[model samples]
Target: MSSATIRCYIGIGSNLDVPLEQVKQALLELRELPESTLIQHSSLYLSAPVGPQDQPDFVNAVAEINTHLEAHALLDELQALEQRHRRVRVQHWGPRTLDLDLLIYGNESIQTERLQVPHPFMTERNFVVYPLAEIAPDFIFPDKTPLSDYLANCPMGKLKQIQI
Candidate 1:
């Protein structure tokens, strides 16, 4: 592995098949990823389904990692981990066993056919903002704004911190 390591943040969420356990297991698996050092994780938060409200609420959290792997490689690894837990992408923002999102990779703005760094909605949603800010309060957005500001602006409706 290279000596270089970028600070990366990932969003983890689950609402099906023992959702709380799924997030916890994913956190442990994240620490075991090759060539990566698990930094820390935020406390889990419960949030209403962002899309269709018919499904169970989601348990969400964020993780910080120091990794030698490039952005896309890391994304692939996350997806593989989700697949290991039997994640099913049946509908847009639908319920799932696990959902992992690459939020930021050391200030790099990445756009590809499969991934988007900064996570597109990281700045707006309470589920993303609260947990991410909890882990990386000083993290800056692509547009040169601090994460805490976004977390503060997010509406605190259905998001509640929960131990999982």
Candidate 2:
């Protein structure tokens, strides 16, 4: 019997050098991952940097994908992509050439030494929720709350759609 497809949401962002170009490139790269297909993507948004706010504003988006890989393997692929984009690990939430986060993984809850599923902070970031809602308006939180309801109550920042 064929295994059911896993639905995943990924958060992408860039704030160093050519931010838009990096986002575009990251999307294309995501489309190329093995055993995976890019399903939907939200428009890009420009947002003030979170965490350490000493750097440039970020260009962010969320993408929905269908994949066959298990969670940690997917995380490995994301990290490999980050290395390709020259992502630096020197600072928390620092400037980056590309940032790809596996925000949700088929309702699975994972806690590991190097990874976390259902991303610990997805709900609090417009960079994540807005794009997610654009694609899957009815997505449910780990707590079983409707995403649309959360979006309705969220004070997320303005997000602009940029054509790829």
Candidate 3:
């Protein structure tokens, strides 16, 4: 039997000093994950912080990666990369030099103390939905809803797509 390929989406953001540069580096590192291929990247976007409004807004975007690794293994690799980049999870929605969140893993729905698939607020956050739609316009949620349709009804954030 051939190995199964899993498609995973990653939401990347940075809000502290030199965020753009940090985000760029993070993307390069993500491309290095084993058994993975960086499929496509959404244009970079700048958006206001989600919760606890005191922090700086983040530079956000989404990327689609094809991997042979299982969902939990991908999560572990992402967390390892975050730690390597000095991501400190001290507070909820805190500012960071880089944040990498696993947004989706194939059609898998996972819930555990450490992770959740399709993310918890993917449809609600323009930062996540917009960029994800940019790269994977036809991607469907577990509920069989098209991403573009979901984005049409979500609250819009201040989004600026950076020209590469």
Q: Rate the local accuracy (lDDT) of all candidates.
A: 0.89, 0.87, 0.86
TM-score of each prediction:
0.95, 0.93, 0.94
Give the alpha carbon lDDT tens digit for every residue of 1-164 in model 1.
44688998899999999889999999999999988999999999999998899999999999999999988888889999999999888999899999999989887898888988878987888988888877777888777988777877888897999954
Estimate, for each residue in 1-164, the C-alpha lDDT of model 2 and write its tens digit.
11668999999999997999899899999999888999978888888898997898889999999999888888899999999998888898889999999999898888998788888888888778888898898898777989988688767766566666
Query: Judged by TM-score relative to the true structure, which candidate is superior, 1 or 3?
Result: 1
Model number with the top lDDT: 1
Which ten contiguous residues of candidate 3 have the minimum total lDDT?
155-164
In model 1, the runs with Cα more than 4 Å from the true position are 1-3
Clashes of each: 0, 0, 0
RMSD to native for every prediction? 1.3, 1.9, 1.8
How many backbone collisions does model 3 have?
Answer: 0
Looking at model 1, the pairs that clash are none
Leading candidate by TM-score: 1
